[model samples]
Target: MKFYISTLGEFDIKVDGQSILRDSNRMYRIYKLFEYFLTFRNKKLLPETIIDNLLSDSESEDPKNMLRTQIFRLRKIINALIPKGELPEKYMNLNFTNGYYCLEIGENTIVDIDVFENLIQKGDKEREYDIESAIESYQNAISLYKGLYLSDNAYEVWLVPTRNYYQRLFLKTLNKYIDLLKRNEENEKIVNLCEKSLLIEPFEESIHIELIEALLKIGQNKSAMQHYEYALNMLEKELDAKPSAKFINYINIIQNYTSRNNDLDIEAINKSLEEELPEGAMYCSLEYFKFLFNLQKRKSKRNNEYDYLLSIMINSNNNKSINDVFSVLKKSLRKGDVFTSWNDNQILVMLHNVKENGTETIKERLTDNLINYTRINRNEIRLIFQPVSMENTIL
Candidate 1:
């Protein structure tokens, strides 16, 4: 007789071809005992340990007796579920000796977690030598990780560590598999793998970055930008934090490459800037902001003009879009200054020939303008003036 126990997404058992559902009190407790015993099947557990792991919350005063009764119930259920003479005598019995209980297993019994671990080991061993076989093994293992382990028992403290351990293993195996795909220059496969991984770990920044990079490699800049925006919004909303500098630089690269039309001569490039005024902040893309910032640094070194970068994030009592805040900023800031949206909620501004005190005055004027022009409350607008030198980068 073949018995299968699956604990990856949910705790389920199949005896032969029929599944055991939790439809009866006897069946439910039997399932719990079977699951607990299979989880540590190789070891003989004391009644206290088994009770603690399986029935720690039970209201029964004498858990040792309860555990003995559960073992008996488990044996009866196994006997009735499996046909007569189908399972070996050893497999049919719940062995209790010297105050220890164990679920004796037969050769035909299978557990999904054990199979998953074995496949991972095989994949790791074969990846360098045989790519196709390794990928097959990895795919098999990845499919086994349907979702969080013992998801029905997610809040159980005892399950947390085991769940996290399996999760880490799954991710490690997946990342290695992805690296192998990358070695084969399988960009589409890389994107697919990243998307699959993200389904399980949606907030994983590394996976998101990898997906974006893969899409960019295939000239899918628009798709990559959409993912970037999604990731940016998700991270900010969930973690109250920004993405890493590496991620922002990747965005800058994508935008810079996508925005290029053709090579322009020095005179044409110079003429493009002729209409811009010298004082109010100029709005630009992240790529353009980076270029102008570098240009300003070079010019500052030669001309001895002190240039600084300031970051502004509106603290609005009501949520407002970046365009609304930018409208107020355009009317308030100096004409020669430049600015760009670091994200939807923040802006990076370049101020030329400004000292510490000048920034304070600029902050006050911007605050007043935001409240007066946009009707945002004065207390709801916050101006953060972080002075960045020519040698530094700001996001």
Candidate 2:
């Protein structure tokens, strides 16, 4: 497939048209710098701005030499793609005006994003014109998306706009795809698509609200209400904002029918969880635990868990600083294990799995681990351990 990097205006490098070894880190950086340039194609992105965009907070001294090396490598890659004899003249024809390399491929270029956007827009019209054509466009749009538009780096100014633009385009295409599916009476397919969209873009309040709407359209009011509440709560907690007026209106409509929005099927899970709570497992106050666990279960990457767990831990410990407890837990986990100091003075150790008698060994290992960790800080952080098993051991 041809590799087209849209810098100034979106340059095309047809690989099938030419070949080059394009795996240098510098080449990738230039690709990114060009990407940023493409997003703000009309504006002249400066070299210093590109350097600042590329550097991390930890990066020292603006590496001009490094950047120069990358630009050279990018030029070499472009040159290597040209035929040996006709290269110099054809390349000289390209522009590098005012420190910004440009790509003036008019409309014939097969850019994945451009193709996706065009097909998505045409898909919408095709829905009106012809069902077969619309389906074809949606398929084409989905195919061209590749992955998230420049999902490599978010902090890079170049990557961010390109990422956001492509992301918005991807979602637009996805919504159009869902709309087409809905028109075809493929409600089941739409439900799955809505679910996947919500997963990919949980921050998208509209999509969640749409999910609820779609669920309700299929008479799945029970599940619909659950999603509506989840979506609203997510917006409130993460964004510190209320649900949109449209969503509130949706909720009001749902409530008017039969208080269906308030009805929840949490009793079953609660009952199971309660049964697991031993005779005196100290399940005193658990709202925060439930919230943290739910958030982690849904999306493990949410950093709010750390603050939430710390808050609960500090609050429960008679306002005493539970910093040692937090430190011990944080240091104990290898990489992907979840351990939370949710209860003040109460530290819960979460391990993936241990051998049959490994729980006992793990308990001792944990105690030793905490002692070693706690002593270094010289803080009084005596913690209790509660191992809550999800699907295996009962109370």
Candidate 3:
């Protein structure tokens, strides 16, 4: 009988194509003991090491005896996994010899973690001389990693380092495979691979950047922009930090892709530039807002226009409240006004054709709008305005 074992993403064992491990039959100590033995299979493990690693949290008066009892139970489970006609010793063995416990499996046994590491090693060896071969090996290895290693045992202290090692190896393999795909200009494949990789590693900024780059290459400009926005929002909301400069650079790349047009006719250019009439205030990225702010500042100076910069600060710790405040701003301000998030807790707006006296009226309107549209208290929302002509500081 052949044994099939899987420890990545989940822990499972199958004998002769039949699953032997089930949740219904799972006992805490028995399952953990079996998992520990399988993880360190064929290695000498002292009783002291086993008890200290697995039973340290529990109070055991006789830990050595407890370890022996658990090992006996594990041996019974392994024996049951053997086929009815085959000898149990031929399939698997659990033994204590030379003052060390060891679990040994037959040569016919297949373990996914062993195969995963082997494929990665094969890819590393082939990468220098045979690019296509290396890519294939890396792709196979990456596919084997369904999720974090032994995710079912996530809370186990002994599993953390090993789990992290496998995860990092998976990322490295994925990046290498992506690099080779890039060399071949297989952008669509990169897009698919990076998208799947992101589901596994959503907080991975590099994968997001790669996904955006591939989308741009394939002329999916709108999707690229949407992903960029999503990534930015995810980083800010989840990590409570802005994306790295490498990620931010994608904005310029996306803009360049979208703006590239061969049409030289003036009418066509104007048609391309034409956009729908604004319904309410316009919202933009902080980067774009800086550009608009500077242009508006120069225009106000030359034309002596009444332009005011409004800063709205939300004091609440809730992200939902901050989002609601932005929603209120969009509906309350005029179409000519523009705004952007200044930070996690603040928003900046450029109000056109508004004077110092008019600022008070606008502030009152915003205050009322916030109260009407958002659950945020009046005291939680603060608004301040300064004329564009008087502002010389950079964003």
How would you encode candidate 2's per-residue C-alpha lDDT over 127-235 as one tens digit per residue? 8879879988887677555445554443455465567777787777777777777778777667766665554566787677667767766776555555555456557
Report lDDT (CA) for all predictions: 0.71, 0.53, 0.79
Better of 1 and 3 by lDDT: 3
Provide TM-scores for the models: 0.62, 0.53, 0.66
Q: What is candidate 3's local distance difference test score? A: 0.79
Query: After TM-score superposition, what is the CA distance of residue 109 in candidate 3 from its true location, in Å?
Result: 1.3
Give the runs in model 1 whose Cα sits over 4 Å from its true position.
15-18, 24-29, 89-93, 240-245, 256-395
Q: Rank the candidates by TM-score, best first.
A: 3, 1, 2
- All candidates: CA RMSD in angstroms? 14.4, 12.4, 14.6
Give the lDDT of residue 241 in candidate 2. Answer: 79
Give me the runs in candidate 2 sitting further than 4 Å from their true place.
4-28, 37-67, 80-100, 104-109, 142-148, 158-162, 255-395
Residue 5 C-alpha lDDT in model 3: 85
lDDT by residue for model 1 over 1-395, one digit each (tens)?
Answer: 66787888877878765776557754666676776676667678888777777788899998888877877777777777665767555344577788777677766677889899999999989987999889889989998997778776656666777889998998888888888888878888888778766666666788888888788778765566656654665455445687778875676765654555213555543533342222345566786566556545554654466667878776655566467778777667765567888876678887767865787788788777776777567666566665444455654
